[model samples]
Target chain A: MSDSKAEASTVPSQKPVPKIKDISLMKAWKDSKAYREYTLFVQSLNRAVHGLKNSDTVPLSPTLDKLIILLNQLDSFIDQCPPKGRSRFGDAGYRDWHGKLEQESQQLLKDALPEQYHNYIEELNGYLCDSFGNSTRLDYGTGHELAFALFMLCLCKIEALTEQDSRAMVLKLFSRYIDLCRKLQRTYYLEPAGSKGQWCLDDYQFLPFLWGSSQLTDDGPIEPKQAIDERFYRDLSNDYLYLGAVKYINEVKTGPFFEHSSTLYDISNVAHWSKLNQGMVKMYHGEVLDKFPIAQHILFGNLISFDPVPKPTGEGLFKKPAPVANQ
Target chain B: MNENSSSNTNGDIDRWLEWIKDCKYLPETDFKQLCTIISDIFFEESNVQPIFSPVTICGDLHGQYYDVQELFRTGGYPPDTQYIFMGDFVDRGYYSLETLTQLLVFKAKWPDRITLLRGNHESRQVTQVYGFYDECMKKYGNANLWRFCCRLFDLMPIGALIDNEVLCIHGGLSPDIGTIDQMRIIERDQEIPHRGGFCDLMWSDPDDIDWWAISPRGAGWLFGEKPTSQFMHNNQLSLICRAHQLVQEGIKFMFDEHLVTVWSAPNYCYRCGNIAAILAFHTATNHETKLFNAVPDNQRVIPSKTTTPYFL
Candidate 1:
């Protein structure tokens, strides 16, 4: 009986061997100690961007040119890291990365903000707290913090552009940001776990901000009402959309979103990535003051609209339809 | 002449005595023995076969004790008919220990009738998370009874074939299980803690949709309609009945009307305001199965009598 079973089990065998490219890719990632290397790369890029912004040797446009180079380098480092198929980092690694990022980002902001803009920085920090801290608030999760940080980065870029040629730079920056946002929005909502068969923003943990026909508007000078509404809406929308997308993706790919094995860091990462995408959209439109009439009315209504009224919560911001392609 | 007559009489007497000595003892004077002999002669008169007239086929009580009693009141008690409790007697409710004890006492009294099977929640890990662990600690002040109950849980049969027609189990079809005997071979001993073992048996959800796959949550895999239809076809079974997910109407039919989920616990944990039901079927005739709501008269308040037996 055993012999018969063994005979039955026997089959012709031809198996493929690992290719040279596969081996080299594995070796490169393994040798690079990608996690630590990526961290260092991010830090260096941050320093390079800051140095270029502060350099006396170059004019504003040339300085931005150097900054763009640094940004490209940062993007390359992220690409090379190759998030897919990497072993999940343990708590220690996560904590180490989180601590380093927090420290570096905080230092960068402190150094970048002028002494006169101390009050503005304080207000920004306070806004961050209000947006991210309140449990009732939509942005009251780790993902919101990441989204806010990404938004800050966009602001920094806008500031840099404004220094060179106020009107042209603003228009250019706004257009680019809007285009990027639209692209990301389409990528996230339409394709959903794109052709690559991977979750778009694995680290985003916030709930999706947009629910049932709501979109952010681009207003000029961030008026008190527009600013408050934008802050609240974006924070909440980002939270809901990011979380919802991740959950949807997880459900399709896995079984359920939140389960025994899911970690806090995993959720946070997905949330952060989602915010980055949304911030990209917001920043893209930040400079394009002419394109969005209604948005302009909501934000800079006193300047643009002859009939100005008290801005109700999300009244004007929600009037414009979401972009068709993104929708 | 006188001597000859006496010898004849004595010889007759001696033959009679020998016959009496050889005979089995029939003690007329021993009252106890005499009583037993008389009782044995009339024993057939008292031999009465208990008639199990009606029984309720309960599915997935799931630690909802209040709901179980509500069911009992609605369905009536056993001995008149028996209860074929289809397992999942613990977990996910505050009163699992009471639920188990009440069912256990009922089973002990009527072992031939009140039957229970092993469910996924009957496992250690499930109990720990759901309510059994806390219930045991609160009731017994120790984990000893919990451990014993878990042992008994292992012995529980995975599936019950009702009158050789209706098949009942806690969960749905598995790729591994083929025959009734295959189910019987499952060792009712300590189960190894793993994904594919007894845990999956109690926890696996069946898919009625086409092209099912493994769930990423690591609990169990999902199935599509094709596999479900094929399973039903191969098994020579009429319907696949299972309970795991919450059913709004205490039952749900899925998979092109092939799969049915019957949840016996209603207003599940006093939340999820759902009506609970039990499936009743007559074996003799291929009559359509009946669904009975075990919900109480007042929907708002859970009756006090329904407090789990372990409390008393």
Candidate 2:
């Protein structure tokens, strides 16, 4: 996993790698270097953020603070582009905010990342720019969330962030990024991009629940169902991403939890957080990584190449047979 | 009416309707049968379905089953107050199976009283991307019902003409189709195409531009007032009624009253906070928009642990 450390001094390729050009390459995506690193990185962050709270102090990193400031700057732009008099969902004003992000993203990335990593700004900027939301669609979802994660992954590969920063990345930096995303969502009324509505975990995100569930591990005082209880959610939401998301849903939506968010409500029925966390990881792989609609938009490059990894002998024993060519 | 009612003699459609009325889905076998029955009914209908006056027009139910019940309540139950649901009956909401099943049962029971046009979301690809496919797997523990429903979707008519004047479709006009007769000639029994008249009819939206522009949705073109009015004039239509786009107001009249959008899923996605509306046409020249909000929580049946989809 630390092989990236060896390549830290090497400059990345000049041009960004081509995106998942077609959906047929989805099989290749599973075997890509990026997929391997992403799974490992997510697992590491999952372990790092375990039992953490928004209030709990973690090892401080200047790089994390810079990223937070960059997010803050973008959040302030929402004030600049207050939603136009509402027509319906996906306000036009979000386009303006996204436009601002697009224009200043390179500069913002330059400021946040250490000067040593400045050479990687070209590739880094695309992920950071797309991380906010789509300007044209005025929508956000796990695809954009994936972009932010990729940005952090780029940072990790470049050694701008290291193993030590994983905990701070999940607790401090990623938390701020989601906060900014929420502000943009509420302020601009960003639509959910390719949302499965009630079937999906949440409208705008998937990872926080994955990482958040890890925070709830070790048979804590709260059970899975209790996470949605107002008494527990209100008290623990700040401490746990999963509960905070439920609290947000409660605020924005008006209906029984089971009716509006049946998927999450059903998930709450699981007996333990560890089980839920493991399920979340598998789901992220199945639902997000494997789904063409999401995977098609992912940009593949040096840090996260689309090139396939060598399939280990007898690997087919554990995995389900690969799906036949898509119709 | 049609002879399809004879199939309901077995009382399965009625039983399914009763189950759906109570917010439950039909059993897997019954659901497959209903799909077979409804697909046959829709297959016999034309690409441009012919609708009568004194009908209520709706848009995009998106599977809000309780809101649909409220809609039936607001605008009298079908057959009493005939309906032309301009597509989008599934996806996004929790009760897609029930909402779609109830509508299908209504069509199967009273083919003459209700018209179900195809929306973009009706297609197999769209359902896979949206919630309906997952909902089927979650509820039935398999994708067979989803496959049956997708077949039914392919069989649905793409457009409806009310009194030969008001052309109602899930989306707006298509550049490939200048006349409703052109729409009539389409072979629509397959997944929606990426382009051409058939796809455009189910994916297009109206804008204030002069002519056709590329739609952001990727499949259809963004038709403006000029082409819309020209299409109406060419077809001698008085109004073009569509339902693909959400209007903050339940009903929106655009292009100087030449086009109208009727949305029927209130508080869409359980959080949009926008009311839904249905248009009741008293005559070719007259219609009323009936508005309704989302059903209260207590009014809707909450799903037990055994029913809802487990994230795993």
Colliding pairs, model 2: none
**Tens-digit lDDT string for candidate 1 (B111-214):** 56666666677777666545576556545656766776676666566666655445666766555655555555565456524565454556567654565566
Per-residue lDDT of model 2, residues B1-312, tens digit only:
346756554487677777887888888888888888887788789988887798999999999888899999999997798999999999998889999988988987898999999899998899998889998898888999999888888888988888988899998878888888888889889999988888888888888899989877778888899998888888899998999888878899989999998899998888888889999999878988899998898887666775332344
Candidate 2 yields a Cα-based lDDT of 0.83
Q: Candidate 2: fnat, from 0 to 1? A: 0.71
Model 1 residue B253 CA deviation (Å) reads 2.5
Q: Deviation in angstroms for B107 in model 2?
A: 1.1
Best by lDDT: 2
Worst ten in a row by lDDT for model 2 chain A: A318-327
Per-candidate Cα lDDT values, in order, are 0.40, 0.83
Against the true structure, what is each candidate's TM-score? 0.41, 0.95
User: How well is each residue in A163-248 modelled by candidate 1, as lDDT tens digits?
Assistant: 23321121222223222322222222211110101111222222122110022222212221222133433433222232334333
The CAPRI classification for model 2 reads as medium
Compared with the real two-chain complex, what DockQ does model 2 have? 0.62
DockQ of each: 0.02, 0.62
Clashes of 1: 31
